[model samples]
Target: MRRKYNPYALPPWLKKSRDVLHQFAIPFCIFQGIRTILFPTAFDVLFLIALVLITVALKIELL
Candidate 1:
């Protein structure tokens, strides 16, 4: 008989960081949407940069 592996199981630190990023990303995305509606030009570039940085940071944590 062969054993199976579980992918959902993660280390404590990784789990915690993953949780934190998930939480942060949600609100940031909401605000970004609001910003897009409220003031599209003022922080257009800034918000794009912030989102990219957040994405890259999360990608590193995923690895």
Candidate 2:
């Protein structure tokens, strides 16, 4: 007998977080990609600073 595929076996929290991350990752990565191609050096520097600010905000929010 073949084993049945299971889609809902994942924990709800894990699934939710994964969905949120996936949503954020798409646009975030797209913008970063476009920024890199259109404005490599300047965008890279600004991206780094923005990333730092985002990390700090996340840390603060989590804490």
Candidate 2: Cα lDDT at 6: 51
TM-scores across all candidates? 0.44, 0.44
Candidate 2 yields a Cα-based lDDT of 0.62
Q: Worst ten-residue run, lDDT, model 1?
A: 54-63
Put down candidate 1 lDDT per residue, 1-63, tens digits, no spaces. Answer: 985644367688877877788668757867786777778886775786677677666666542
**lDDT to native, each model:** 0.69, 0.62
For candidate 2, the TM-score is 0.44
Off by over 4 Å in 1: 1-9, 42-63
Off by over 4 Å in 2: 1-5, 38-63
- Per-residue CA lDDT of model 2 for 9-30, tens digit only, reads 7688876875675446446756
